[model samples]
Target: MAILTLGLATAGSSGAHPDHGGGREDFPGEGVADGSYKQHDGDEGHLPAVSRNVTLVGKAAVTNPSGAGNTGRVADVTAFGDYAYLTAFREPTCENTGVHVMDISDPAHPTEVTSAFIPTSDGSYAGEGIQVEHIDDSPFFHGDLLIHQNETCPGETPPGANSGGISLWDVTDPRSPKPLAMHVGDFTNTAGGLDPAPNQTHSMRMWTNVFDKKTYVALVDDEEATDVDILDITDPRNPVLVNDGLDLGAVFGVDQAAPTNLTSVFSHDMMITKVGRRYVMNMNYWDGGYVMLDVTDPRPGKVSLIAESDYAALDEERSARGHEISPEGNAHQSELSPNRKFLIGTDEDFSPFRIVAKIDSGPHAGTEYTATPATDSKQIGEGTTISGAVTFVGDACAPLPAGTGTALVERGTCTFQAKLDAIIAAGYTAGIVFQNHRDDCLSQVSMAAAGPIPFVFANRFAGLRLLGVPGVTEATACTMTTPATGGESTTVKSVFDGWGYVRLFATDVPTKPGKAGSIRQIDTYAVSESQDPAYAGGFGDLSVHEVAMDPENNNTAYLSYYAAGLRVVKYGKNGIQEVGAFIDEGGNNFWGVEVWKDETGEQYVLASDRDHGLYVFHIDC
Candidate 1:
């Protein structure tokens, strides 16, 4: 069967020149915490000359203001005029919540607009698919509407079990937005369902151009076993499906670079350009970089692959030793420049550097390199430390170490054998590992079966290590703690479990200095750590997240890093500088970012924090 093809263009500044961290101004030190706390024992500081200019901006409490609590985890950001749209998984107070609207007319002072309920979720398992837009017309008729993807219908039970769908809101009134309508029922149920039956929409957009007098919105129904659906939402209250399945060329033919056995052209995220005359798509986890499809014929528009940048083309090892979640390489979030000259993508891996290919030209042509250092500079040879923890899952800890002794293990590496063997080889004590991030930690059942030495798992940040757990390995354990804390910091209660234990220390044996994977120095804290493939354990607080900038004004950028809340900066030829930042002293993570200008000539910044729920900020400080 012929498949639809879409041309993918590269956008943004080409070339992976050294990130000098330019375009930043001195940050007002008042009301801000010490920026020199050392993110990772030996990581860089909040300087104004880093490759990605991200300064810590004023941070507002997303969980509790009076109390120092948080709802960790930020996702994406959408800006419309002077407002910012934030989507978080949940909040400490709201808990597994929804979207938050923020006002950022003043970048320094951000205020909350409003928050919509998304209901509780099993961590990242259940939640909402959110996207906001300011009224624009090009290929389709248009009106004011805010559309978000729902994991399930509004009133459904077990949102986790229910499939995803779409929800429309009337944001004509910025202050008070109302739910305009929700497409539900048997047909809506099977849009893009996980079950063979399909049930939710993955990606959606409304286009307005020379084509129609009314606004036309198209949704990629994940539940619909066939094609994407084009809907005529000329009337906000009344929407009709123009075409459910737009025919495209076969996915195999479209995927020219098949480094691994992954499919191509699977409907993922799409961007409307050329005034809705063309739509570019990134088929889920595939080889075809970007596809350009002509939606002129909404019913049967032709889709073709125009340009592609393949990761496998550069690193074939990505396919063989790649992790399961992103085995085919993450063709995930991709953006194109306004001039439609460049296309940039984000790889979903913890590699020291991010993947930036020159979709346009030059030495960076089909090239991808690490955006940042994978490991700390000093820790480059003595081996990497695995102590900075966020969320640990697994069994409760049992007393040991002094009496029988306990072993500390990290979440990565599925089998507990490596840790146990290392412990047994060293000859001593009980055993325990920080639980995996994504799964509940399983106890070392077989080891305990033989009257094991208090085999247990510590699932708390405090319970993760044993700073001074005495034994033959006492020196190693003591090395992990900060000498300033007098190396006497005891374990606080675990976030998941009620119990706690001292932390442990086990650095990878030091390799040659400056070597790719060597530990060089020792520090009091870790800004970034290592990750484990098994149980997806290594994904916690080991890597540096992403930061984005405004093309017109590079100095204006947002940093949504883990633990590092929302950092607003003004970058330029000077150097990377910090303006202000908002951080949840408690646990909270910041992700995706987008800045928009509304019709009212106002600027809004939207940020998606992981799990903490959506955050709305007004940047008028």
Candidate 2:
């Protein structure tokens, strides 16, 4: 069994990136605190248990029989005709729990038609993003084709195992889905530093272009070394690699040189849409932001750059800190309006902080300083100013010495929470400032909990300056401020202040024959005021996850607003407006949502909750 650890960063810049720490770690026994699982307590625990015009039609507790040590969290869901396809991560035991096929013909009660698992010599399982495509009058095979990415955790791969890519299956027999082929790709460790190149496939999207008379599948390479891989699946059984390394930088007309921060340049997720005669692919490049490429000519294995968007402009304030560039913002996912006039992008920064400090007295009095907030520190208030003596904890990365004094600013190891606690125990009431251990700029720190007092982090130069000051060593005093409240406030501020919002852009030329021709910035849309702090667990309080367009209405869009539940927005000449929303009473942590029309022509919204099972809602609008 694996013990879930809440301290481990689970939130990705976007939903597509693997869990921050990389796959699930194994530990003994059931219900152990392994730091892998997130505590769904408080607002994240349960939904409100109420409903509006939206009614929960059908649900399947696939993850039930919990305590198996595996992540019961359902990854993604896709529907076709009378069935729905669901994929789940491997169990804690590293057992394969592949795909779950549901008979959703009756929306109110979904029944599992069949469950499939991938066999691995090492016991690791398969599952991540799953999609189904229908091929009619094809030269290869016919009926429904199921394709799912085969993703294993960072260290979970067996010896001599090349275990990551897309798995193809024939689901014509829903009760007996047969595995057709497994296209194994490259593998690269995601634990930071370079280990290898060409990472494994994380998520994929496949479609048959009627106009081009061919089928294509695009998969994210999951590592920083590679961006995306395009495959030709015209012969479902024999998938061929079209391009192993489709460089987004080259396609976007940017420098092909490797970025200093490799994580920022990798491809995390992608979606393909047909706008008029052009087949466009919208890629969510981690730090690169939103990138659009023209894939109209896939046969040539070449993609044309359309328009690329970056959030560097938003980093001006952060760059001013220590005169160092702030890390790239996470551009996790991107979706377009039904009319393709507006592009909705999501930035996924799990834990973010803004540093604010000022010297209250001494020669440095009135001198302002910028320090980042520790993810584990309690939120500081604007009205509170903590003053104390300047002290050093210990050597960088070493344990603090016993008998440390109180109310003193201690500089020591970069990120040892235990050392920080030791200083607090010695009666440090004012605050603590940690010095960066390496030459790189001081980045944000993720802690398990907020300590007794405020904890601010300083860059190397700032730390050296403080150490040199006589007053600072004797009786240094400083004021610290953060968002209003503590826990809830930190959660809200981290997202709102960070990069996880929507960015809309226009192309240099018209995507449609009669649409506008020039490129320009469109208006940005955030959650409505109703989601303010006053309303606990409101839509505006959470980060935006995935967005889906209403097929029938070019102006309508549906969003899975993580903890905010489901929201419906309308965008057009009048601008974007929130037309409707439904926050389940049970407390919703919605991950992905899709809008589909049934055989009877009635439109419904299918939403996947990280905690709850599948939810089917009637789109009244």
Candidate 3:
């Protein structure tokens, strides 16, 4: 029911906008081998060409009845002792209950410990924010702690009323998980009111400073304008909000007082690393680039800006689209190198192609609509034009007023797949989806449904433009439901603008007391097909999703590439280079990954595949 929400920007600032919070990211990509494209069976698109330097020692396809969004059966993976905690995330409907327990003592055969599963929150969903740590210093309990985010099912409210923000449990005994905190942030009511329901959150990190010895959780709150929400979790029984809804741009912008209007920049993900006594938080902020902050004291007045990523200039080849404009900024996620030398970031571009919807005639004739892809349909493969098409607006979300069944889109009542299926059945060339003002109307997300014809998704502004309606923003709560096309002929030109990739930066950690630290992007990496036109449309999205660093080898990191598979990279002063990669014969749609070591200190990578299940691998190089 969600489309990539690439809305228009007004002004204000994260500096990227008036462009709005950055979130244009993710998808499949390029073929690695020379053989022909092998079409995948369960999932759409061809299997990425294979390559292997990582060995799959074991695999566990966790059981999860598909959510409405068709999310990965298993999301984030974290290990404590011989047991691994795998979080289940299916939006709208959480059929899988909660977290899945897996016994990984035997690395060669990872098995699910069904008896140890935690279902504290039926609606509790965790995406890339799942961590289990043995924090013996917490005042609450001297045992293992498990924390996961409850970001809710986008656009739909699930079961639990008090399960909105973050959930914490005492997992001291792998077989038993004692619930400590049900909801530990601003909670959303069943009626969508504020106060006990969890504030829609995406990613979070928990760390106990070696110096302060105080445990804290940094969360990315989607419901708040000032996204970063910090909490003191030293006592897991009751979390105290230390910094509530603090806008990173205002406090740390180049001009602290008048921070660049972070129009499109919003905090997405974060990496907490200890630099000496200072706890540095490297945040993946869309459009705002990666922002580094010092949170050693865990207070606003004490926290200081370490560095902020600036994409003012770039190598022409790295731009992908060759457009004169700046790169479509979607600073999705980031991780710092273990050696503290550099950090790698990802700009997730789900819709690598931009669709220019030009109005041919009618009341608002000749006006063109171009923004992020909004319609949540399968890949269009090789951009093409949906020419000489007549525009019809359907109520996608709900049924039209009694007897009025003429809208072209599904609005929101049915799945985009259902709508796209109808469109294809009706012989429509393509489709476009815009976000409702209620949720992230300005954010860009990559949610899709398989369809034959091309489908694109955009933000509220673009949606308004397509319907010839005036701009209805997230603030005003645009409720004008009537769809109007003004009887115009539409020409939709799908242009390939390249997919999301990685940006490597050389970081400078300030040694002097008053000196400011900084980060300079050293290089960019994308699959050859993602950069080349010859491989366009045939191969799936080559965009990188998440990266897991190898503790044993600081120079080595593992990437869970959607269709590209697991890629191993080595980085240093020489920059980053792919040393190894592994893609199953059927291709891989990996979402999240974690690196865990067994009792003998043998390191292995755990990845969550969207269509498939869990995969365990060991890096050879």
Candidate 4:
């Protein structure tokens, strides 16, 4: 039987180091509806008594070719002088995905103003976040200079590998936003050539320098360090690349891997806080923690690694107490206070990420308290065997003879891990998982170490079944007859199938907003001890991925998970919660999220669902 890998929480308060953390004053404030106390030190005690009046603000369904698998995966969101913008990309198929626009004049309600295509079908834009700012040109400035990352190659067909370039949008009017320029310059001419096998860019940050009166857009190129590309957007229509002779790292920082043109690393998601001539760029990581870069000079600028934090070693004692982490990369997304005092890093791990608050500014800032997982708490599944050999479509185990070896399960039928975990929990150690049929021909496989046993994965259950009896090396050369048909089982077609992706979900909703008014009251829809073949959820027991707050109200947030559709959460006092979930009956899935505010303050949510195009919704009584 497989053992459960339940671990501990985060470590306790660290001793008084030199205290190089930033100050609370500089951190961005949530801007509570009422004059509630705002304490940065990660302390919730100093705040005043506030009732959770959060109500469901509704959601806007986003439709696109990528379908339901891409909901709530809304990568990045930022509010500028007078607008709120969102960005999305294609997954699975990696088709035509681009930057979308919504006017958030009214926080509660949002209007879809425009959506400009990224000007290429080479690969999905894979755009994560959006930023818009007006230059000093009054009426002429009507055109908002928008910047975003393009992480796909420029000429490759969809459903294959992805390459990318950065995109610039010209949103002079709310109704007709257009693309002004696209800078694929960085990847346009490498030694391997512009259309380098994997042509793409990852997470990017854009900012306007008050000192130089220049607008800069920085993007991290997957694989290599020095992947920071600087673009001058002085003119909204035309953009120029400033930083050169270097490499653009991955959006999520470098790890024990080589830099690739189409991988994510370095700064997955970052924020550019302007403090005078100096700009603070907080980059996320693979293991490099959060690095603060000093980009005062756009040209020939210097980058430095300021601070680093690692959850990999938060001892079982510390983890069990409260800290729990998934094997995901560190610092998925981060936001900065308007003042730039505090930096909030949201680790995209399955569990909650530690919210590090910098109390005293300038080289002596003290760090303070409070840490919670991103999703609701729940007991993880143990381990079990999974099998994809029985093609439900075929209604029979492969033509191969039924054997006594452990079963290798494929991911498509239901929640990827749940099935395997069930097998282990029910008393099986050697489980094999197969790739989804839709994946073109490439598969990303990993072994989930449930205690001491091994959980291996393959392109199909047939592969695992072959490995079961040991010494079954030449899988392509062996054949066996099935019970019904006297024919031999089919051979393994492809090893690198395109169907594997890491699915994560929350354990349970926070009883309280853990972070003051920003806490989202979670509705424990229903917990199950085993995977109901009928339900066939996603990876985690729930199958959902990430949770995001209403752009305007922290209490109101959206939940996006595959098969679960989109869930609108409302947090209230004394444990108030409600869910407005729109599910897909035909296997559609959700993965990303972003709230676009219309001119009237009304909020509109955009989500990427697999098979289901982008879904748009609203939160009103």
Candidate 5:
């Protein structure tokens, strides 16, 4: 771990942030409605967020032209020249879910370039993984390029709903998008699934490897072992999948039955840039921490690990709340500094609170458990009384027999939500689904649990322990085909832990192209209220989502801090220090952040507010 330091985060009781205002984290395509809205409550909910040296230049509300309503339907965005392209999120009309181009000539009044709207398939949507890149040296194509991930909307499929994989378009002209490649790397939805979907393309980045004189795209496989994808896009029209399903566990040496310091491990987001002549990729794999790879070749077998970060047994954020607990892994999104000296990452924990259980009566009784809320459901009441009675078990992939209690199911077979649905029909109130295979054998991953039902997504050992299978350890391999067995009374109880925050890695530069380096963890940062239990209950999410480096200065990093608004921090020899912040009147729910420096070299921070549209801010101080 690197040198640890606490950010000058504002506290929960300070009245600087917005009231929870009954708002909940609404995932893009899942569309889980916030059920906590209270009527006529207080002034804090509508109060203007505290502003420091940041100034709002202009704003725009993504609207539905059909008038059906498109409130908060924006996800990721990218900027090039005087225009920016935005991705649609859970659009009111799923069919119309596409990319919107914004004319930013007049930063004070940026408007959507409707004519440039790049729509997806008939019944699908996009996620937070849209990127625009310029392949300066590629011979196949010469202009600006855009790539997007297509995900099928929740519920029924609308006819030939062919979705999944990455789509490419030439956006040299913001208004007239020329299709270069459509759904090039899609995968089947199920086993031997006929209709393919681009479900795994959660977050991706493109770059031109100077060493190879070619271009490539590295994307996340959200739910599969083929987690890291590097597509050769030297020919914009015909992309080649250089590497398929490269499992992190197999490559990182943490996936096997060894005891890993990292808890949750999966590729989520990535940033690619150059260090001298070497091309490096900084990947944020949940609890696996930040990993830097030498991707100079941008091909399958050619990639090699350069460095991986380690987490503190009790990181700064956890200790902020005075808890001696370990860091809740969420290494979400990150990028190395332009100077190639350090990397800044944001750990997004929508559900700040975590669930840790202990074996109550077995030989392994009193042992600590690895757990995280699989569902974003309502809090199971304040002081933690075990909610339901009895416990049932089965591999949740199938419809289990009726059992009116908590359901203990195995992972895989179907979606987490589908498993919950099956158990609910069988009268189960909550779920405890464990890892069914090696890919997820020992990790505690956060789920896009789609319903109101609460659930606990556990590691493989947790499931076996509940089934009364003794001698289970981190090294025990899981049987993918075995269904867990347990009566409605397996011994277990739940307790809450601290929220998620941020990590800072000090860069250890590699020598040259295809060389290796060690990127070490030097420190961690989070908003003061993030670890405060008082803010955990409400005030929206006090956690940071995404960040962008100031093109004007590498030490300056702008953060899209959800309910706490936009935060401006400067990283120095000591650590990161917050310099400014902003939350609009009525509060702001910022999602994605991007720094755009126009031809004039003036840098603007474009923030996507989940409740509102987009807000452009400039760091004045």
Candidate 6:
């Protein structure tokens, strides 16, 4: 068996203090109702709240606190030796547009080492993905290399600007990182007419093997019909393209299907791990679930597929949920356990809902309804029925006739909250139900405030049924029901919504010649036991975003539970157990988490909050 070991060395400590940068903020305002918290202007003094064992040792805002477009929010972080590299998702026009280098010899207070940005003439930026590795023994180059993804949004590329791809930097001198190479993709020609908007790299990883005597980086092309792009970086100054693109469907005999949720066939993220002597690449193929590839022989174009996960059956089941299918099941990202016995995968479902509306009374009585709760509508109680005369209000975007009936039925337009407010002011008290203006089904609606009365939504077809009911007029009485139990109330039942959860898979490495190993589904972990009223009948309040396994302990996995904060879980012969958690009271939209060790061999959790800045925590368990 090939036992792969990561050769990481600890660096001597260096004491340094934080330095503040001064400049006029560019881009948009810090906070503009982007669903997360408003950016606190010049509030770098704010620190993340933590549990008893976890400490807020070091804190720094990479971007100008007064700027806009994710200015102060740190996107990702990577630790190597005594320094930590952080990526920020700020506007291209901002001064701090690239990776922020921090001297972490002193964990309590990380000092700014340097700031590095991609060398571009048209004012490009870098931040999305980053990885650092030592290549001292390589024949072509020897030193520390920092690789980061250069991502551009659709139609945001400046004329004559280099297309998005990967950028390599030599950080041997932590205080001054020098550019090594810039690799861009060909956007003019894309497979299956897939649009490579903004032409950029979505995610990437660097890998090296002593026995193979080669180093490579895998890049994900975030365009339709595009696949994984592999590059040989043995010579950091001159990266060679080994594979233009590796189409998993064509190579592994797998077929593509229509996306049910947010999942697609496009490659989102990939991780290369050494299992024994052989290296395997586990890819999170959006809707494709998890795919395993044999990259042991990563010769320019000789990679082979070991096994690809099958999610067609799962997709069929999700499609059966009708138009209200939750977005919880789309495989967004994944990570393998330290022991290599299990693979932890996460589905990125940010917008979730738990709305249950049923038709009460009339010919359609007893018919169950799937509706979205108004962003600002008040939560209805169990056994609470709103029965009143049905009155049709014109298109909600425009001014409605004065004093429309109490139970208003309006067509969706503008904002759900705005429509509700207008009707309520005109004296509509019982409730409101908005029908879809488009022919397509209404998936989910974001209501900003819960109005004074209950509110529900229906698709275009359901609206038609309600409008055509016989004997139904402004005086016709209809009722809406909320479950009596299981939801927020003792009698109210919670409705299921969203498609975010974690799944585990197991793989056995081959030990002898002519012997083949097997990969199969093992166990799964979710927030099903959550007692939070918000996720009652939904997919739970915790939408597992990304996971990082403890390097020292294979059984422990740290998860960035969006909204639920950080969660520590352990899995082994005893099954999965919740070991610890730290939920920031201020609110947490954690997108990434990494497990790093200090010189004393103590482990710590580094998390990136999409709304706030970076958070450092010491795991007690």
Report lDDT per candidate. 0.37, 0.54, 0.63, 0.39, 0.65, 0.55
lDDT of 2 by residue, 171-207 (tens): 8777677878764444434443433323456678887
lDDT of 5 at 357: 54
- Clashes in predicted model 2: 24
* Whole-model alpha-carbon lDDT for candidate 2: 0.54
Model 4 worst lDDT window (10 residues): 15-24
Highest lDDT against the true fold, candidate: 5
* TM-score against native, each model: 0.49, 0.68, 0.76, 0.50, 0.81, 0.65
| Model 5 C-alpha RMSD to native | 6.9
Candidate achieving higher TM-score, 1 or 5: 5
Model 3 TM-score (2 dp): 0.76
Give Cα distance to truth, residue 563, candidate 1, Å.
Answer: 6.4
Write down the TM-score for model 2: 0.68
- Residue range 1-621, candidate 1, lDDT tens digits: 322111221111011001101111112211111101112211222212222223334344344332424434334556565655555432222245445666666665667764533332332212223555555552332445776654332212324433344556766565677766564212533325433222455456666544455566666554332355677666656666666555333432445533332322344455555522344443322233334444544654343443344333323222222421122233334443343433333332322322211111222222211111111111111122122111212222222233223334453433343444455444433444433332122111111112233333333221222322223121233233222110112111110100000111111211122111111111111122222223123233332233444454523555454444555654333333456566543434456656555566544445565644444454543
- Model 1 residue runs over 4 Å out of place are 1-52, 63-69, 90-96, 114-129, 136-143, 152-163, 184-198, 220-227, 246-252, 261-265, 275-288, 301-305, 316-328, 350-588, 597-606, 611-621
Q: What is the lDDT of residue 448 in candidate 5?
A: 52
Tens digits of per-residue lDDT, candidate 6, 1-621, equal: 321211110010000000001101112221111122222234232224446445556655454433564533456678787777777554323344567676777777766653443333234455446889989768888899999876542224344545467878898877778888764443434433433433456678989965677898888764323377777788888777677658776666544442222223456688888776677888877656677777776653567666666543332223333432333335667777777777777765443433334444456554434444443456544544445445556545565656634444554435555667677776765445544433222222223445767665544333434444444322222232211211000011233344356666676655222234556666666654332334533222356778888877778888887556788888775456666777665556566788877788767788776665566787777
After superposition, candidate 5 runs with Cα above 4 Å error: 1-48, 65-70, 91-95, 156-161, 186-199, 254-261, 367-378, 387-461, 471-498
Query: What are the per-residue Cα lDDT tens digits for candidate 4 across 295-366?
Result: 656565355333344434322222333433222333454443333333333333222222221112212222
lDDT of 3 by residue, 61-120 (tens): 665544344344456677778888777765324455467888889988888877777763
- Candidate 6 regions with alpha-carbon error over 4 angstroms: 1-56, 69-72, 91-95, 114-127, 183-188, 191-198, 224-226, 253-263, 299-301, 311-328, 354-496, 511-516, 528-542
Candidate 4 structure, TM-score to reference: 0.50
Clash count in backbone of candidate 5? 11
Clashes (backbone N, CA, C under 3 Å), per candidate, total 158, 24, 53, 132, 11, 23
RMSD for all candidates, in order, please.
Answer: 18.6, 10.0, 7.9, 17.0, 6.9, 12.6
**Model 2 Cα shift for residue 42 (angstroms):** 7.6
Evaluate residue 228 in candidate 4 and report its C-alpha lDDT on the 0 to 100 scale.
61
